[model samples]
Target: MLMIFGTWASQVMSRTLHEASIAEKYEQWMAQYGRTYEDNAEKERRFMIFKDNLEFIENFNNAGNQSHKLGINKFADLTMEEFKATHTGYKSTQPKSSKTVSPFRYNDTEDVPSSLNWIDEGAVTDVKDQRQCGKGITILSFVSSYY
Candidate 1:
């Protein structure tokens, strides 16, 4: 009976210490990402998302079978829906048109290369760092015509 009690007490203490360490990690992540909430409720909500994301990151990395791995970033505190809605703006409501378009450039499959290196072609823009500003990836599309 004494051994049983001792085991239970040790288990409880271990769990408490593990939880404390997790909470400390959350605090450090929040500080790094400059995350803040208006109230305790909001903080708790974000913390749940953050914890879920951390678990996913860990599991993905531990698998060790993939060419790439996931990591916690500035968007770690957000849910998938929240991140998409906020960062990936302009979801088209219109139905897809059954349109066939002809390519202006790279028209000939035989002439075209298998893959493109836009950087080598000097078509790519300079890399932008949004450190502390915390901006999401944005793509711009433009249609050109001779005026």
Candidate 2:
């Protein structure tokens, strides 16, 4: 009975350590990619959701008889409904143009001009942090227009 209790305790400790290591790795990845949350509670919630989705995707990918391809991406914190609503909302509201015009064609083989500095030409912009209010779209649009 003592040996059994010792083995169980060891297993529990090992699992706890493994989970801690996984959480550490996740935090590191988030920091490297400049991800942040409003507060500790939000961060913990998102991390839990990310872990569950990652495990599900890994299992699906490893299944022998699976036909559909399953992969993990940065949007694991978002649910399917939220993702669809955000991305697909524009599709239904697209305005139709009555004029039929020839599409402009570009020559892919042509080299870019040697004197072109993309940064100066307004191709790149500075990053701005939008805290709490979720006004990222408005900020980005204003910045792009100003540049």
Candidate 3:
């Protein structure tokens, strides 16, 4: 779970950082004064730092606790949340027959409703999709206090 969290968190953060860097550069390029050599140089420097930070994050996944100094604990926490949303208790699928209740599958048959309704019922957000927000997984994780 930790490994999965680390990988996903790194991917999300990397993408976010890339987007932010691009936006920042675009904003600078569109300044009213127009672009200057020094402005370009400064932008490049900022981009380099962004790139290095992303690389550091990627390397941190394998660096054990070295990333903690860089405030990666929050990233790790986010990764764990993403992992829980997509995985955790996902191995078992709901059974087709009424006799067996599949703990894994959200919706088994017509009789039982899926806990997935929680996501659907709540206000949708950019952060998560309805199917990805598995209520059962959240419950188990919460009770177990894993994260």
What TM-score, over all chains together, does every model reach? 0.59, 0.52, 0.22
Off by over 4 Å in 1: 1-3, 90-147
Clashes of 3: 1
Off by over 4 Å in 2: 67-69, 90-147
TM-score for predicted model 2 compared with the true structure: 0.52
The number of the candidate with the highest TM-score is 1
For candidate 2, lDDT tens digit of each residue in 18-114?
Answer: 8897698678768766789999999998888878877788788888688787765566776666676675443544466977876657535465554
lDDT assessment of candidate 3:
0.50
Give the alpha-carbon lDDT of every model: 0.79, 0.70, 0.50
Q: What 10-residue stretch in candidate 2 is worst by lDDT?
A: 138-147
Candidate 3: Cα lDDT at 16: 96
**C-alpha RMSD for every candidate:** 9.3, 14.0, 20.6
Question: Per-prediction count of colliding residue pairs?
Answer: 0, 0, 1
Over the stretch 34-110, how does candidate 1's per-residue lDDT look in tens digits? Answer: 88899999998888888888889999999999999998888999898788767666465566688976676645446
**Deviation (Å) of 112 in candidate 2:** 50
